[model samples]
Target: MRQERAIRTRQTILEAAAELFDEFGYEGASTTDIITRCGLTRGALYHHFPSKESIAVALVDAQSEALKAPERDLGLQSLIDLTFEYARRLQADPILRAGVRLTVEQTSFRSPGSRPYRAAEDAVYRQLQLAAQKGELLPGLDIEETTEFIVGAFTGVQLVSHVYSKRRDLLERVSAMWRLVLPGLAVPGLLLRLRVTPP
Candidate 1:
């Protein structure tokens, strides 16, 4: 019970910090803001996170949660589902929002050797590798290069959506992104069968 309470306290502090980071960006958010937001004492906040940068790093690491999609046959569709799931989470999850925001604002937070982008790239790379094994991807397509491009493209799409409409149109934008990229990535028959939109 004590362990559970400790876990909950850590989550509470993380979430309160996320909310502040989302609203104010990394450099703008302070430990005081998080403590006040969560109604936790300075000691409690510092006990969980030594500094605001540690809180930001925790949020950045938490982005792995956003990559999770329901387990399904690993293929191009699974990869597509992953992106849609991420977009959906971005629309709803404050922690993910703050993480993405901090990832782009790396100059401000500066978590050394923190490879937030690599996590997404590795997720996409794994799916692409599976797609290759299953013959879902186009022949001669380089999985490594494709993984980088797909992750990079989705990053741009979501960032633009966040900037323009606060991600209100993120799902639509993701569908459009798949539509344009799928033709080039998947084989002809598989491309036609793939659902561009979220289920």
Candidate 2:
């Protein structure tokens, strides 16, 4: 029972920290803010995460695991579903929002671990490679380059939506992004079959 309570306490701290990081970037968020947000003592917060950076890393790791790619038939739909699935999560999950924000600032943090960006890139890369095998992708499109481009584009779209609309229009923005990117990536024959919106 004590162990379970400890697990819950750690989860609470992580979530409160994520919320602060989402509202304020890494530099803006402080341990005191997170502790106040969680309504937990400083000792409890430090018990789970020694520092704000540690809390940030924990959020990144947790969000990374939560971002499982949606399963789909190996084709253009697979890639489309992958993007929409993550976009859906981003719209709903504050922890993921914070994690993505941290990933965007990974270079500035200069801390250990590859973080969420690498995980997202790897997931997209796998889907792209599968599309290549199924001939769902455009001819001569390099899977690695295409994966990086799609991931980068998705990141840019999310960032723009967050900045301009506070993510209130994120779903529509992601749908639009898929519409613009798919025609170039999906095979002409498969274009009509791939739906930009959630499946």
Candidate 3:
């Protein structure tokens, strides 16, 4: 019974921390704030999480895992749909948006050796390479360079969207990015129509 209680307590602390961190950002939030929000003592928070950085890592880990689901299918369309869906969710969810914002704004607070990001990046690279091998992508395109470009472009769009808009129409922005990028990367006459209609 005590073990179960401890697990519940830890979950509660993590949940509360996720909410607070998402709402207020990393530097904006403090340990006392989380403790107050969770109605738990600092000791309880510490017992569950060694530090704020740990909580951030946990949140990123969870998000990254969620992002990995599409890689299992190993299809180009599946990957694109999954990524777009994730961007849509991030745009809609304040907590997610805040997390992304925190990661981009506060580089020093981010985990130094985060496995989640690296794993996700590797999965994406593998998927692209596989597509190239199967002739799904254009011939002669450097798989490594293209993967890096796509990842950087997607991250840049998310950051720019967060800065310029309220994220209500992030899908539109993502679509715009796709229209511009996909045409170049895709094989001639094979660029799939973007789902996001122009506003």
The clash count of every prediction, one per candidate, is 0, 0, 0
Cα distance off (Å), candidate 2, residue 5: 1.5
Question: Using alpha carbons, what is the TM-score of model 2?
Answer: 0.90
| lDDT (Cα, tens digit) per residue for candidate 1, span 147-187 | 88988899899989988999999999999999999888888
Q: Pull out the clashing pairs in model 3.
A: none
Maximum-TM-score candidate: 1
Candidate 3's C-alpha runs over 4 A off are 1-8, 69-74, 92-95, 107-117, 193-199
Clashing residue pairs found in predicted model 2: none
Ranking, TM-score, top scorer first: 1, 2, 3
How accurate locally, in lDDT, is each candidate? 0.87, 0.80, 0.68
Q: How do these models rank on lDDT, best leading?
A: 1, 2, 3
Give the C-alpha lDDT of model 3.
0.68
Q: What's the TM-score of each model vs. the native?
A: 0.95, 0.90, 0.80
Model 2 lDDT, full chain set: 0.80
